[model samples]
Target: MRSQKLYTSFGILIIFIAIFFLKQNFLGEKYQDEHHYLPTAVFFSKEPIPSLDLLKSYGELNTPVPFILGGWVVSVFGENIQCLRLLTFAVSFALLMIFVWGSPDHSKRFFLCLAGLMIFPNYYLCSVYYYTDIFAMIGVLAGVVAYIRKAHGWGMLFFIGAVASRQYMLAFPAAIVAYECLELLKKGFSVKQFFTGLLTDKTWLPYALAVLSIVPWVLLWKGPAPAAVMTMQYYDSDKLIQYNFGYVIYSSACLAVYYIIPEVLITRNLRYFIDFPKNHPRLFIGYIILIGALITLFPAKQAYNPYFTWPYLGYVDQLFMTIGITGFFKQIVFGLLMLITMMRFFSPYFNLTSCVVLINILLLGKAQLSWDKYSLPMIMVLWFLAMFDNHWLFTASNRKQDKLFYH
Candidate 1:
């Protein structure tokens, strides 16, 4: 009862903070997808200009679904920036509710953590913009929550909705496939059960519904080709030929270390003193693959990719802030504790691993001249470390008590 009250208080606090930020004007709200989505709302009721010159010069319909929906919003509520931003604000708030309600273990700390995440570039930027990313993430989070609750049928519906919102959502589907494959392997690939579930399970019904929703777009909306979308139109044959093998090898090594460390720390339930089933290897692997996809999807030349479509980022932002803070006594204590544990357990293999990762980020930032989005992933890594560090501290304390009592 006390915990519930605390969570409620925290939720209200976070919501209030979010409201303040959402309303404040920030440097004129210049970002990608702003132009793309807002105009759909602008010209919805009005007949679209038939001139190919206008479409070519300014607005080429990027995706039909968002435009159609934005058009609907415009028709109902009158076309304006605030109306479009309000739609995003509503979705952002919905995302908060989904995150709070969907959490299996809802605590005050979680809400407080979420409040801190509200300031992340991705979360803040999306909250005030006109884009489908928030909508897509909301669907994905809904699907994840439903899946966790064993409501696979509902989960699939959200999954399909997510994919329909943005086809690049295949990264998440790939993660799901990896997870399911791991489970199947553990069960010795029960063919009869697998086939039966695939054919008759309600979980797959959303996928069926998704097909209905998607078929129209797939058949009628002719925009960019598959190759254009996937390759991001930046990969050049000459660049590939000129690529230095040594540089490639070093960068790859750095990225692997960056992801593997977090996966090892969090996925094993090592921080929580809980044991995950062997059947759930996909949990860690899925996370790793998702991170990899985020990095790779945004190629060197392109500024944005389909990253924010995944909802985990908002919470991940909280994790970053958790690590990025300094000066507080609590922060100092936790930092020392983490430093000691890392030196004790992992230093032998990765004495300079942190430095290497930092160097890679700095180099990448210099190359791109955009270090802001990189903070999203960087902060998540720090949060992963903090979680494990705090877990080990508590575990060691408990073990010490146990030894004293037993002895």
Candidate 2:
């Protein structure tokens, strides 16, 4: 009844947002990163597969698959920015649908969250601007969703597609491995059910395909090995390590609070939290940390001073500033939101606020806050969580159905 209407309205809102982007071609921009993909596509009349020499020379570092595909796309569509931008936007939209449909047990709150994700100023702005990163992110999320559902074949396709979209997506594959390993350890080997199949066969298939797929890059690029090594130098960089550590710690702290805190604080009862076991506070937090750190680490470059201009700070601070003029406004808002949500009565509103605050923290710490590239996943995760939380507000006690969701 009320919940269903909320879901429908949210879906409609998503439609409106997509239409808005479609009308303006989002925000058109010059071909970014390497235009090599386009030309390569033209050359092969197929998605350009990376050459062996290219990978060998570059330490097989960073996936070159996306470049190959992008090149092929330009060849098929004719060399034009409009065609490329449309492809990126289409992929992003497709990702949203995949997130919604791919999960079998989604709730009304998930729908609201979906709407929130679509309307994110960051994602909205990026769709207008051309970015390969967004496409790769779509593949990454798709792969994760597929894997979670036991769709191994499709999962590999997505995982490979993601890495090909961007070389750095290796991090996603690595994370998947870790997640799968944990699941395996908990459930134990089950050859009969084929859960073990993922470990023994399907797991390594992508690496093999990736290796074979990237051969073309090495053969073609004849690029400098030093440059490739330099690209990977972040693994050894202290500053990068520090940032990664901070992100890990902060994310873990948030998740611990979300998971450990009794629902009674938010629901005025203990049973709801126990019932809605599918809330996945832990998974949600881990996903955030994994995605956030990868985003920070992989991008070759970042825009200067991108965080100072975020609009949410003013909105958040305004609420807090009813008391005073000076202080870290974002922190004040964050504290207030946490406190309110901690008190069960205002949990629904506060959950949404907490998501926004987390997003802001992510955006603020990073090199840039531009919608052209970053925040696509942040928007998706936030909206998805918000919508799900909304539905949880209605149920007297969490059911098994409520616990199952796309992790």
Candidate 3:
């Protein structure tokens, strides 16, 4: 049975790889962000090492890691754009391997979940682009997996790398801290006991290190902040709340249409919830009304102009676009069902991951426009937590142990 499952997973992975390869080759350049990085890479390749002044001149808004990686690739492979895409594909493939390997004892369910994640549209879309988001995502996943396996040192290193790749990843360490607090509470520890435990726990040293990693980036930051960077410029509390509420609704619909639905279909769990509405007519009606109101008030529309060129958008945008009210209804239903499944099957991790994703989305709402690129890290983290089948830190049985850790 295990062999069969492994074979099935490998088969799926092969197909996924082939699809991405074809898309990159036939579809042409689908991401515009590459224009920003390609020039930085070329300049860096010529320099002995990237100086802070050089980065500042380029008006590099984000951290220097992606440019450094891109520079190294250009240095070795020359200036072929396809090489950069291949590099992204290789990193993405590594992320898949990490996901498969991180499963609890390499369980079939975990492998199946990873197979579903690989085919997610946003994830695959990013993979074909020469963007830094993939690197940040891989770093975050590596850190999470390392911490889960009780490798504190490696976890700290990976987490630090993640932040360097994308500053927004600071949310991840905060999420880990929150999860740890919940773990303490689940063990019947008082608030005092929890604080004491947190202060003294050697296992938590890595998180502290991860948090401190942000200091260097902040101190050394040289360029003007990009408009895409999260800031408090639009900090009207009431307006912020209103905008974020709408952003969440719209983002949830996108996730449902592009990611959650595919996951449900692949896991064959759609049938499990098919009779829910029939079982509770009033509750079902209430849900429908609530969802309908949200859709009407905060409809999902393109957050930004298409990241691809006009000719490319003509074909690709239509393929990914969700239509009007009818489409919104389908998305809300599938999204709600996916959330229900996640809570039922993976409550503790689900809640923790949701907190991280929600906080990140709210932060993104401060920007002028919402780009799918900004949400990729959060989405990746969500899928990771959703697919994780091990006992969570907050499980009652796990809490009974004096040392609460995932393994």
Q: What is the lDDT of candidate 1?
A: 0.44
Stronger candidate by lDDT (2 vs 3): 3
The sequence of per-residue lDDT tens digits that candidate 3 reaches over residues 329-381 is 54465346434433322333334654565556556645434444566676666
Sequence-dependent TM-score of model 3: 0.71
TM-score of 2: 0.51
Q: What is the per-residue lDDT of model 1 for residues 1-407, given as tens digits with 9 covering 90 to 100?
A: 35664576576557656665656732245356675567655654353422332222224324334544566677777766666666776777776666655543523334333443454556666666777666666676676567556687777778677656654343343334434433344456478876665565444345445535544444543332122332443332333334232222223332323333343443433432122223234553453454344334432222233532332212322344477632243223323332223322222122122422333343333221222333333332222222222221122233322111111
TM-score of each: 0.52, 0.51, 0.71
Best by lDDT: 3
User: Sorted on TM-score, highest at the top, how do the candidates line up?
Assistant: 3, 1, 2
Q: Which parts of model 2 are misplaced by more than 4 Å?
A: 1-47, 53-62, 167-375, 378-407
Q: How far is candidate 1 from the true structure (C-alpha RMSD, Å)?
A: 11.7
lDDT agreement with native, every candidate: 0.44, 0.45, 0.60
Task: Give the C-alpha miss distance for residue 337 in model 3, angstroms.
Answer: 8.3
What's the CA RMSD of model 3 in angstroms? 6.7
Alpha carbon deviation, residue 354, candidate 3 (Å): 4.1
Model 1 segments more than 4 A misplaced: 1-32, 45-64, 105-119, 190-216, 222-407
